[model samples]
Target: MERVEPMTLFGYEKLQAEVKNLKEVKRPRVVKDIEEALEHGDLKENAEYHAAKENQRIIDSRLAELATFLGCAKIVDPSELDHVKVSFGSTIIMTDVKTDEVFSYTIVGGSESNPDKGLISFGSPLAKQLLGKEEGDEVVIALPNSKKTFEIDEVKYQEIVFECD
Candidate 1:
């Protein structure tokens, strides 16, 4: 069975835009470059042709990846889910037990996760640990270096907003 990934509307639209841009703008330009390179000289030792072919390969690979991601995407509206417990699209406010540090995390799709921005994928280790947990529950997350405990202070379902840089 194909795995279905939960994605917010914002995330879905973002990916769609990227795919469209690549298909319409970038891919055509690369194809033209390859065409121009092919006309330059002998195919045996043409550096420009080889480089263009490599670039086309990279673009095709990325397009394939995006296609797969879009095919299995399940758009989920965060506002529709229950906020009483931690789950996909839930925003959690937590406190680190050891250092008393506060952190806020929003569970998002793999394509849109930004750890620095507190947007974590639902499949992430931290989000996995927090799933099914309720507010006031303590969760232990196994980091790469060590395990840290956190108290789930809030499980909220707010509108998921995507910001452009």
Candidate 2:
């Protein structure tokens, strides 16, 4: 049996949109390019044809990856989560014990983690330390350079919405 992994609602929607774009738009465009390249003559020395074929291969690989993700996805709605303690889909505000700096992060599944946007994966070191911890709790996270302690100042559950492009 295949293991079903949890994916935030936003992540699921994002991947679905990507799959749609690749299949409906990119695939057709690549096919057209390949057809035009074939009209350019000799198959053995056709650079355009080779490039188009490579592009098609890349697109197919991406499509397969997205399909696999969708197959194993179990969408988790943040709105259905509780704010009592830190968990997957929880938004938390924490203060650095040493530097007194504060930061906010949303704990999400591995597939949708974007550290620059304050999204941390559940499998990450920071998220692992924060999980099941409540507000006012202090936890230590080990980094590549050093270990840092942080105090959880707030915990909340809010829906994460993604704007489709």
Instruction: Name the best candidate (by TM-score).
Output: 1
Candidate 2, residues 1-165: lDDT per residue as tens digits? 997868987788889889999999999999999999999999899998999999999999999988898999898877787878998899999999999999999998888988988988888988888999999999998889989999999999866654454
Report lDDT (CA) for all predictions. Answer: 0.90, 0.89
Candidate 1 residue runs with Cα over 4 Å from true position:
none
Candidate 2 Cα misplacement greater than 4 A, ranges: none
Give the Å shift of residue 67 in candidate 1.
0.9
Write the residue-wise lDDT of candidate 1 on 1-165 in tens digits.
889988988888888888898899988988999999989979889998888889889988988999999999999988888989998889999999989999999998999999988999999888888999999999889989989899999999877666885
lDDT over C-alpha atoms for residue 159 of model 2: 68
**TM-score of the candidate numbered 2?**
0.91
Candidate 2 weakest lDDT stretch, 10 residues: 156-165
